[model samples]
Every structure is written in structure tokens, then in C-alpha cells.
Target: MLRLQSALGIFALLLLAFALAENRRAVSLRQAAIGLVATFATAILLMKVPVVARAFGAINDAVGAISAASRAGSSFVFGYVGGGALPFDLKVPGADFILAFQALPIVLVMSVLTTLLFYWRVLPPIVRGMAWLLERTLGVGGAVGLSTAANIFLGMVEAPLFVRPYLSQMSRSELFLVMTGGMAGIAGTVLVLYATLLAPLIPDAAAHFVIASVLGAPAAILVSLIMVPETSVRRTGGTLEDPEMEVASTMDAIVKGTGAGIELLINIVAMLLVLVALVYLVNAMLGLLPNVGGAAISLQRLLGLVMAPVCWLMGLPWDQAVTAGSLMGTKTVLNELIAYVDFSKLPADALDPRSRLIMLYAMCGFANFASLGIMIGGLGVMAPERREEINALGLKSIVSGTLTTCLMGAVVGVLS
Candidate 1:
């Protein structure tokens, strides 16, 4: 029965992809069929390939190192905050300081490493290889294909750099595909941070984070192609331009990348501080309202009500469906970081292992209100003529992207 349910979920996802392509003149049934098969095949590679699995293990080790470093720094500042010499001990009850301050350093280091990899031309080949496959299988233009592939590792703004020259010339459907891809996957820097964040709760979280990244890649491609098929004049046979390393020499690259990573680290810490405080404020305000069933009707609760059905569809047990639903809603309406924070705060035994794993895969992306601003600013700056198009597609991209990740989560649940 579970296998049948899993098959049904995969079929529904493919049908959704096909529907998105239906509007395009170039997207024949044959093309859509090929694209769907390719996506499934890629999903299998991400899950089963030994090389890919080992790469994820490396990422996990990096995350663990960062976590250890952060803990060392935290110990220096707040001695015994977690009832030990460590800055924040995971074994200590109610010790969220590690998450609040320490986890971001991993993002910083990963960002610098990512820049260095790009400088050496190591990353582009992998991105271009994925783009080539997407292009050949889906019949997408090169620019769109590369941008979507690049998005798996880089942010929405950064991915566009791969196809910067063609931004102004890209058709509306292509632009939408780019936007949808951005919303679907997360930056590599943040992936490490999230791995550390959930390590305490979810076993093998590092591997899961890596799998989520790869799985989200094709999921983004399929969803974007579905929402807006390639219908306009297609540019043919253009190769992907290499990403800029933004440095003059190897030493320069290292220094500059490190500096940029510091800035990113600071921004992440500040954002978390502000967003967490804002949630508290909102909850306090809601607490003033009359209580229902001895609990105040807060935003999280409201979100849970709205998203519970979706969570159940993803195969969460009944006891945990609402909690998982609330997290999903928070991720969509607020941000993934906040949702993960909430997930971390849940009581032990609140969710079984399976549901927890499912939510981790589901929430690993950049789909949120902030990303709209990012899309508008990043794409708008690149192609001023398409500013309106960027704005119009922002909300839909978020919707489609969130739906795509959820679809993947449903599939993962069935597999499990």
C-alpha cells in the first residue's frame, strides 16, 4: 500500500510538470516525457550513488567541524551557559545558544570554500554537466538550463551570474523558470549550517541535507517548467559563461571570499535575532486574545490549521501532522530558518523519526517573503527591462517552488 502511495505521489508530481509544459509550443508530449524520466533518474543518482553519498559525507564532516568551532567560541564568551565549560552544550536542557550564535560559522566557511572552488573552475563543470543533461532531456535553452543548475549550489542572485549576458534577452517563460529554481533550492553555504542545526535531533542529517539539495535541483526544474513553459523565441546553442571569482589572484580570491563570508555570517546572525524576536512579539500580541482550549490562537497555530492537510498528504503520522504542517506554513510564509528553529524547539517525542526526516527535506530551500525581495533586486538589476516581469513572477515562483519541495517530501516519505 505504501509503495502504491509513493508511486501515486511521483505520478502526480510528473503530471504537474507536464501541465506546466502544456502551454509551450516546443514542449511536445515526447519532450515532457523525456524530462520527467530524466528527473526521476537524477533523483535516483542523488539517493544511491556512492560518489554522491560520499560527497555529502564530506559536507557533513565540514558542518561538524564548524559546530565544534562555534561551541569553542561560545564557551569562551558564555562560560557554562549550558552548565559546562562549553559555550553551549547540546546535552544541557534549553541550550539554544549554540543554534543562535554558533551554527552560522559553518555557512561562513562553506561560502569561502565555494568561492574558492568556483575560482579554480571546479564547480562550473559540475553545474554545466547538470545543465547539459537538463537541456538535452528537457529541450530547454542553454541559459535557462545553466541558471537552474547553478541555483542548486548558489543563491538566486549568484546563479544568474552564470547566464548574465542573456538576462535582458531571456523570454518571460525563461525568466519564470529561473525565478522558480531560485525559490526551490538553497545555497550551499546555508546547507552546512542547517545540517549542524538539526544534527542533534535527526541522525544522518548531513546526508539528508545533501540529498535534499540534489533532489531539490530537479524538483525545481520540473516545477518551473510546469508553471511557465518555454513559449517565446528560443536562443540556440549558447554555452554557459563561467562564474566570476571576483579576485585578481589566488591569494586575493581567498581573502575576498573570506571577507564576503564574514559579511554573510553577520547578516545571518542578525536576521535570526530579529526574526526570532519578531515572532515572540507576534506571539505575545496573540496571547492577549482569548484562549481556545486553554491555548492562545497564535500565528503558528493558525498556520498549522491551514497546512495540516498538506502535511498529512506528505504521510506524517496523525499525532505529528499538525506540528509538521505548522513548520511548513512557517517556512512558506516566513522562512526556512525560522521553521527549523521551531522544529528544533519541539519537545522530545513530539515527532517520530520518520516525520522529522520528512520535514527536514521539505524545508531545505530559500522560498520565503525575503526571497521575493532578492529576486526583484537581483534579476531587476540584471535586466531593468524585465523588472515588471520579475515582480509579477515573484509570488508565483514562491508558490510553485514550495509546492515542488513538498512534492519531493511526499515522495521521500513514500520511499521511507
Candidate 2:
């Protein structure tokens, strides 16, 4: 029964993907057929292939190492003299810090590592190689294609830097593609953090996070193409650009990267602190309202009501659907980091195994409201002439990107 349900879920996801594409172009039976085949191929590569699996393993190891180091640092700072020990004894006091487990340190280390790999010309080729394959099969442009591929490792904002020279020249469809790609995949830095947060809740979460990143790449491309089909525009042949020599010496890159990481760490910690407090304040306000069903109407519950149907469509069981939907709502309205924190706090039996896995994949993107503003501001700076277009498309891109990741989750759920 599960197998049958899974197969049906995959079919539904493909149909939905094509339906989204049809909004932009006439749904050619031929194109739909091709897209379905390509979608399955992507899923297979991400989930089934041995080499790809091995690569994900390598990435997971790197993330795990960084997470361990961060936890060690957190322990040193909080568990040591200045930091007070917890009333309830735990092995690592820093592990109690919500942000610490999210692998902030891993992100810092990966940023420097990725920079070093780029400088050595090792990573771009692999990115370009994947881009070439995608272009050959999916018929996307070089700049958009490369940007989408690079998004697997870099953040949406950072990926644009790889093709920084082309933003001003890209057409509406290409611009949408880039934005969608950014929204779909997360920065490598955050992946480790999420892994650590989820590890305790979901077994093998680090491995799952790595798979989500890779799987998200093609899904982003597909959904973006659907949202804005390639109309009449100059078709640029896809080619991988040579990585620029290190901006500074290797040591300089490390120092700068680490400095940048420190800033990110500080920003994340501050944001989490403020957001968590804000949520509490909001909940308190809601508590002032008259009780409904013997409890005050809270924001999270309201979001859950709005999102339950969407979760159901993703094939989550009814019992767990509301919980999953609420998390998605939190992610969309607030931010993923906050949503993950909320998810971590849920009671042990609140969600079943399948639902938990599905939610992990669904929440794995930068599709929140905050990201919308960031995209507009960031891209506007890069291509001021297209600022209006970026702003107009911002909301649509978020919906499309969030839906794309959710669709990937559905596909995975089916396969599982």
C-alpha cells in the first residue's frame, strides 16, 4: 500500500510540475513526457545512484566534522568559567544553545573550504559538469544553468556572484530562474546547522540534508522554467567558466572567509534571539484573546489551519498534517531557522516518521518572507535597472520556490 501511494505521489508531483509549466507555455504532450522522465532521473541520481550517494556521504562527513567543532567551541565558551553550568547536568552545555546545534560553525568552516576549492578550480568544473548535463537534457542557458548548479553548494546571494557579469543582461525568464534557484537551495553553511538540529529528531538527518540540497537543484530549475518559460530570447550555449584565481592568497581567502563567517554567525545568533523573543511576545498577545476549545488562539495554530490543506496534498497523514502545515506556515511567514526551532520543540509523538522526514525536506529552503526582501534588495543592487521586475516577481518566486521544495519532499516521501 505504501509503495502504491508513493508511486501515485510521484505521478501527482510530475503532473503538478507540468501544470506549472503549462501556465507559461502550451503543455506539449512531448514536453510533459520529457519532463516526467527527467524528474525521475533527477530523483534516481539523488537517491539511488551509488556514486552520488557516496558524494553525499563525503559532504555529510564534512558537515558533521564542522558541527562537532562548533559544539566543541560552544562547550568551551558556555561550559567554562564565564558560562554558568546548567542546573540539569548535560555533557555539553553549549549543545543546549539552539544555534550551536544548527551547525553555525560547520557553515563557517564550509565557507572557507568552498572558497579554497573554488580557488583551486576543483569545484567549478564539477558544478559546470553538472550544468552541462542539465543543459544537454533540459535545454537551459549557460548562465542560468551554471547558477542553478552552483546553488547546490552556495547560497542564492552568493551563487549570483559566480555569474555576476551576466545579471544585467539576463532576460526575464533567466532572471526568474536565478531567483528560483536561490530560493530552492540553501547555503552550504546552514545545511550543517539544520543537520545538527534535526539529528536528534531524525536518524541520519545529516545524510538527508545533503540529499535534499542535491535534489533541490534540478527541482529549482524545473519550477523556474515552468514559472517563466523561455520565450523569444537569445539562447546562449552553456559553457563552464574557469574559476578565477584566488582573490587573495589562500591564507588571505581563509582569513576573509572566516571573518565573513564570523559576521554571519553573529547575525544568525542575533536574529534567532530576536525572533524567538518576538514569537513569545506574539503568543502572549494571542493569549490575551478569549479561549477557543479551552485554549487561547495562538499564531502557530492559526498558521496550521491555513496550511493543513497544503500538507494533505503533499500526502502527509491526517494526524500529522496539521503539525507539518504549521511548520511550513512558520517557515514561510517567519524564517526557516525559527520554524526548525519550533519543529524541534514538538512533542516526541506529535509526528510520525514519514511525516517528520517529509517536513525536513519541505522546510529546506530560503523561501521565507525575509528572504523575499533580501532577494529584492540584493538583486536590486546588482541590476538596478531591473529592480522593479525583481520586486514584482519576488512573491511569485517565493511561492514557486517553496512549492518546488515541497514537491521534492512529496516525491521523496513517495519513494520512501
For model 2, residues 1-416, the per-residue Cα lDDT tens digits are: 64455456656655665565625453334544565566657777777775786676676565456555655665566563222455676785235455344334444665566567666666666655655676677766677777776677666665665555467767787798899888887876677678878888998787777777778877876677766776655333345445354456889878866675565555545544555576678889999999987978777678778777667666687778888888987887777877888888899999888888888988999887667755665566556788899888888788778877887777777777
TM-score (C-alpha, index-matched) for candidate 2: 0.72
Candidate 1 local lDDT, 1-416, one digit each (tens):
64455456666655655564546555556655565566667667776675887776675565456446656655556555521354433684335445434444444444456567667776667655755665666767666777776666666766665565467767777788788888888776466667777999998787777777767766776677666776766652246566454567778767876676565455545544665567668878999999987888777678778777666667776678888888887887677877887888899888888778878877888877656655665566557798898888877887778777877787677767
For each candidate in the order shown, give its overall lDDT on alpha carbons: 0.68, 0.69
Candidate whose TM-score is highest? 2
Mind sharing the TM-score for model 1? 0.71
Q: Which numbered prediction scores highest in lDDT against the true structure?
A: 2
Going through the candidates in the order shown, the clash numbers are 3, 3
Identify the runs in model 1 with alpha carbons over 4 angstroms from their true place: 12-29, 56-132, 236-300
Each candidate's TM vs. the true structure? 0.71, 0.72
Q: What would you estimate as the lDDT of candidate 1?
A: 0.68
